[model samples]
Target: MKVSAKLFIVGSNSSSSTRNAVDMACSVLGVAQLDSVIIASPPIEDGVNLSLEHLQPYWEELENLVQSKKIVAIGTSDLDKTQLEQLYQWAQVKPNSNQVNLASCCVMPPDLTAFAKQFDIQLLTHNDPKELLSEASFQEALQESIPDIQAHEWVPLWLLRYSVIVKSRGIIKSKGYILQAKRRGS
Candidate 1:
């Protein structure tokens, strides 16, 4: 069996969310360690706009999980060559892979391809939207599900997506999403 998870850090606030997401995923999947965890951060500007300062803490948190044996490998989503290079140079646990959004780029940039090849980093493709879940959409879902006025004040902080697979059979056994939210004022 193998378990893979993806953490989407919503908005600009992802301080401790990475660790919390991984811990919650581990608990939910009944596993001590996830086979892989890919982080998808909110888009800042464009391919050149990924901020290292903002990403450093999240990467550090994942590195801690790696050191503690809570995660086997960690990767990132939608980073260009410059951004990936900056992250790779600074990260304690270098990214093992990077996911490119095919919806945005029909062909992978040559520089990014060369860098990945040089570093032996796997280049994967995905079709996830730039914003996986928006605050307004989250509030709408909350209102629909809870039918409470207070649902409007809640803000989604992050989303964790997990998939458990039967490795031997190459089939998915289970998959689900876990969302974390907070009140507007708090």
Candidate 2:
């Protein structure tokens, strides 16, 4: 039996905890790299919160991984027109795509659409919340399920996704999640 594979994971911990997530994902998936990882993050810079100054560090890190052949492509979630423009203009390795949550807005913003077309940056639509698997919710769920466990002592770091495929079929053979949990507060 022969199986080929591809996985694109949407995640909310890229800015705060990318390394941990990547490490865990690599271990669980038994693979060296992911085809794509669309990371969730909010703008956190002064003045123009969505400027290159805010996003450059994160994207550069991802870019380094790409240059080192760790990840094939890096994408961002929930960036609007001006933010994406800032990133595109300043990044050494331009993002392969940007993901917009349709739930937040019924349709893509016109400015974003136009910019994406001009720059050829793929715009993907997602239904997932901007903050997927928030720490408080994940902890609450775990506490309910396992009374012995101190859920608060463990932080929900991130998620890793993997897939197996049959090349001829062009369909996924299997897929799974590797969740990163970091222990804290003794």
Candidate 3:
């Protein structure tokens, strides 16, 4: 089975979290390596926009995994032409592909298309929401799922989605989501 995983970093998280998530996925999937791991990191809400600086740490971690043969390829989600160019130039391991949200822009920007073509990076389309899960929605679900838990105090750190595909037939065999959360204070 060919396994692919996408890690969604919802907020400010340590670079090491990427390593931890990959390790967990490998352990669970019982595979020493994954076919690909795509990162979907939301911009930090400090009023500043998403920049290469915000992505460097995460990319570095993924690059390390690639070097160690734990992950074959790495990609990004929701990055524009400018952001993608910055990362591609600065990164030691260039991104193999990028996912553009069709909902945001009905047509893929020509600049992005040209850049991807020039760099030989694959351009993929997706309709995923800007935010997969809002904090309030997450808390509500948690509270309902586990009646006694203090849902409000817990903050979701990251979510990993993995899928197993039948390579020969090009069919998905199984898939699941893994969410990691932490308490507000320690």
In order, what lDDT does every prediction score?
0.89, 0.67, 0.89
- For candidate 3, the lDDT comes to 0.89
Q: Predictions ranked by lDDT, top down?
A: 3, 1, 2
TM-score to native of every candidate shown: 0.93, 0.78, 0.94
RMSD each, Å: 1.9, 4.3, 1.3
Task: Determine the C-alpha RMSD for candidate 2 after optimal superposition of all C-alphas.
Answer: 4.3
Best by TM-score: 3
lDDT by residue (tens digit), candidate 2, 81-174: 8888888888888877888888888878999999999988899887865455667887998899999998888876556555666668878767
lDDT of predicted model 2: 0.67
Model 2 residue 36 CA deviation (Å) reads: 1.1
Residues 1-186 of candidate 1 have per-residue lDDT tens digits of 999988998855756889888998898878999999999865465556568886788899999999999999999988899989999999889999999999979999999999999998999999988788988999898898888568778888889989999999999999999988989778
- Model 2 alpha-carbon miss at residue 159, Å: 2.8
